[model samples]
Target: MLVTLREILEQAEQGNFAVGSFNSPTLESVRAVTEAAEELQSPIILSHAEVHNDIIPIEIIGPIFIQFAKQASVPVVVHLDHGSNLNIIKKAIDIGFTSVMIDASHMEYEDNIRIVQEVVDYAHKHNVSVEAELGMMTSSGIGGEETQGGEHHATQEAEDYYTDPLIAKDFVQKTEIDALAASFGTVHGIYVQEPNLDIKRLKAIYENIGRPVVMHGGSGLEIEDYVNVIQSGVRKINYYSYAAKAGAQAVKEYIQQNQNLFYHDYTVVAKQAIKEDVKRAMKIFMNNGY
Candidate 1:
């Protein structure tokens, strides 16, 4: 059933687990995410990033997302991830997204608060949930292109972009967002080195904000890290890079073994591979494996 982000996060908080939010830019991705969620009996946030407009327009993808969410057996939240501006966010809202994220983290503190507050006001009136980012989650470019989405693949220092607990408290109160995406040590895309997450900072932010905390660049963390973050107060995790890479790897292996491969042939392999990858991730996010 289609549900709001707030509803899913509330359940996560009560259950002491985190819900996985996966970026679904294609039909195969939509199928894989919803299918995995249904099979695992896990609530999922099926997201589409504004940065993916070049790959596929929101006008084209939005209804597809809603359709899948409506048909899924498990609760599904259709979310706009890293929405760059009001125009894109408004479009998603009009297209029936249950949740929208206003990403103005690159702006000054006041500006971020102003933009996000504006969105929260508009979205709340429509009964949609809002998520806003405070800190700058840096990306890693050590390997190939870090991610196809807006996150990950930067050479900047992660510590420099970590969120302050006090400021996080202020931002939440100012914006009135349903959730806050705070940065600590995690980056977007594949990791070049092992991530040393600041569980202390995360706990502080959670305690101070008194709302659900979102962790972006959530693709490559260790199982222990997942458990710690969920315990600390993470209710939502945005994960994509690793699952996308897993699908790509599967297609590569299929091509190596077969000749005369058609588009459907390898896309099927990729969809199943992505489904399995997402299932594993959802299990970890449930916070019961450790």
Candidate 2:
């Protein structure tokens, strides 16, 4: 059934497990994630990043996502990821997105709160949930263009971008956001160095803010780290990069194995590979000895 982000995240918090917020920009991805969630009986979030407007225009994909959510057997949240402007966010909301993210972390602190507050007010009136980013992260994954690159920045310098626990509390209070995406040690795409999450800082943010904490750049982490982050208070995890990579690799392998395959055959291979990858992710998020 279609649900809001708040409802899903609240369930995640109670169960002490993170929900896989998969970036479902393509039809194959939407199918893979929704099917995987239903099979696992897991509440999943299907997200479309605003930056992917070129890949598939939101106008075309928005309603398709809503329809998929409504048809899914398990709870589903159709969310707008990394909505950099209010105009795009508003458009997603108008298109029936259950949740919208206002990513103003790159702006000044006061400006970030102001913009997020405006979005929260508007989104809440429509019975939608609002998520806001509090700290900056490297742009290395899909929808990562025009942002700071992780390869160009050193791992040690990442601490400079980590979210302040106290400030996160204040920002959530001022913006009245339903969820907070805070950066402690993860980047958007792949990790240049080993993935290390600041569990202490994450716990502090969760305790101070008293709301569901979201972790962007959720791909590329070890299974142990995924469990640790959930235990430390991460309720929503935005994962992509690797799952998409798996699908791309599957297509290449299929073409290599078969001399003459139709376009539909390739889509079948890609969709199945992505579905399996999503299922693995959902099991890990279950945090139930999977």
Q: Which candidate is the best by lDDT?
A: 1
Off by over 4 Å in 1: 142-156
Sequence-dependent TM-score of model 1 = 0.95
Off by over 4 Å in 2: 141-156, 288-290
Question: Cα lDDT of all candidates, in order?
Answer: 0.88, 0.86
Model 2 residue 110 CA deviation (Å) reads 0.4
| Model 1: ten consecutive residues of lowest lDDT | 143-152
Residue 17's lDDT within candidate 1 is 90
- Model 1 C-alpha lDDT per residue in residues 1-290, reported as the tens digit of each score: 99999999999888899999999888998999988988889899999988788778999999999999898898999999988768989989999999999888888889888888899999999999999898887777542223432344455566777899999999998888999999988887678889989999999999999999999889888899999999999999998999999999999999999988899987899999999999999989875531
| Candidate 2 local lDDT, 1-290, one digit each (tens) | 89999998888877899899998788998999988999999899999988788889999999999999999898999999988878889999999999999888888999898988899999999999999988787654343333431122443477888899999999988888999999888877756668778899999999999999999889878899998889888999998888888898999999999997799998889999999998998899996432
RMSD of each: 2.2, 2.2
